[model samples]
Target: MRPSGNAVPAARRPLAALDEPVRVEYRTVHGYRRAFLRAGSGPVLLLVHGIGDSADTWRDLIPVLARDHTVIAPDLLGHGRSDKPRADYSVAAYANAMRDLLGILDVDRVTLVGHSLGGGVAMQFAYQYPERVERLVLVSTGGVGRDVNPVLRLVSLPYMDQLMHLLRLPTTKVVGRVGAAAVRRLPLDLGYDVDDLLRIFEALPDAQSRSAVTRTLRAVVDWRGQVVTMLDRCYLARAVPTLLVWGRHDTIVPVDHAFVAHAAMPGSRLEVFEGSGHFPHHCEPARFLGVLQEFLAATQPAGHDTDAWRRLLRYGRGDGATDAGAHLADQALAQSHRTAT
Candidate 1:
């Protein structure tokens, strides 16, 4: 069913108009309010943002995608305008929350597009509820490798919560803004990422937000690096249309993880944005939307086959063979361990 909303005419509008404002809506689930942006009317496309970001991250792309599809971008629990509380901030929990939110909105299945932490959530959602996902678009996704930014590893360390408290000081905030401004002027790859990084940094000052971010980070990461790896299950991508997008110069998650993940997931498409950082969608909105639209047009949505899913679970690739899948799984794990050490 199409999402019930006033449809914006596609003809009169430019494809990626940043001036367009997508209204925010709220729905109460499990005693907390969840904020989301819903627009357009066609097949469902759910956009999940990375950690410390709100639904507003997709502001520029929403108007473009909404012209042809029903787009739903939700601020995951404990972030954005959504209520942040002491709760389970694990990837699996966030996946379940997406399920409930979509159910409430009467969306049964979706072409899921996720970035960074949200990409990990998309993978977990696809794994947990395969029937509910039609396609997967992982952009600078986590859980594919062990190497992450040292800063994130530090954030996952114990007692970082108190340090976050110190960052909330007025003088500290001013200094941070100035630093971010200076970074934007530098000739560095991080210059493209500083704004989003600054937003995440700004959010950390809140007590509840700090706890939420800390718990979320610790769930999939540690002082060593990322602990969760999806390589073992990459074979499942054969049953679903998967697209992997990454910035060639991503320092936070590293672009190498994209190649590793692409190698593991058979038939998955990979697009590396040159001169882009962690936020490729923001860095190259036109190219990002073009690649996405092309993928959508070329590939048909995956229909959930219950028996096929069961076979894939039991036999790895539903080909009655476990050796190849097992080998790939082992290789992925070994690579992760090697990186961690």
Candidate 2:
């Protein structure tokens, strides 16, 4: 049900500064109009935003990242300026669409950066097309652990589809406003922050967006938590340079996931923002960009070796590991050197 007109919260406020003008482009993918943001030039950096979020999520970080890297941020289907369609919203499907979008744009080999739900999609992308990703960055990503915010779990219920429909009604805007106001007044610092949560509600005032959000979330989450996990398949990411970042106060996806995933992936780097919530990049942009730039500068791009990959599959470890893997190991050792010195 909707709240009164004056009860709704304000639109999501921009936390990051966008000084430079980024270009927005559109293309037809699978008969749907897809929108994306592009700027700067150098090593390709593909940024994927989470569910209920658009390319706008990257607005603050893009200006700086684009200075040295060609930044490409896409609005996943059913979010942002992109067309909302009743289609398969699984991670695999989103990955395939990303592949097609890149192919059409004539872009090759990219450093994939994904946030939240986008992080799951990024992992799926790397898994499906290993040769295309050079490095991987997951920020408050999903599909890494079983624990998630109960809000997401609640949405994945049996009658949630009907509930989502009710949320799309005219009354929802007022309810959203009231909820947002109530959440904003609470002291979220004691646990997880609900600022982003309120924004998600603000974005779902219409039927189309509401349906898209429900379908997208249900594909990866359920009443228990996350139904899809990348832990088992993390070994596949061994050849690709990986970095994990999370906020200590993240309520949606626990920060423990970053540590668990870092340990599982051998030499992957992990950085936890002590003062941030679910959206670290928004809460701590400087640190986020710094860590990203350093990782990109230090690590080598991954090049797939079919023989080595097959050997990895057969022997449970590839004797012919890529130079990228060796580079990462070297970086680890060098860090040890600095520590010793």
Best by lDDT: 1
Q: Single out the weakest 10-residue window by summed lDDT for candidate 1.
A: 1-10
lDDT of 1 by residue, 1-341 (tens): 21112221132123556543577899999999999998888999999988777777776678888878899999899887788888988888999999999999998999999999999899889888888888999999998878899989998999999988888889988998888789879888788687667766665546888888788888888988998877767576577899999999787999978877777777789999996789888777778889999998888999888887777778865442245644544565786652210
Question: For candidate 1, what is the TM-score?
Answer: 0.88
For candidate 2, the lDDT comes to 0.78
User: lDDT (0-100) at residue 319 of candidate 1?
Assistant: 46
lDDT by residue (tens digit), candidate 2, 1-341: 43222121223223445555689999998799999999888889999999888887777678888878889999999988889989888888999989999999899889999999999899989888888999999999988666788888888777776787776567885777677667667877523455566556666657888788889998888776777777555567787899999999888888877766676576688899998888887677777888999999999998898887676667753333345553443343332211100
Candidate 2 residue pairs in backbone clash: 2-171, 2-172, 3-174, 3-175, 8-177, 9-177
* TM-score for each predicted model, relative to the true structure: 0.88, 0.84
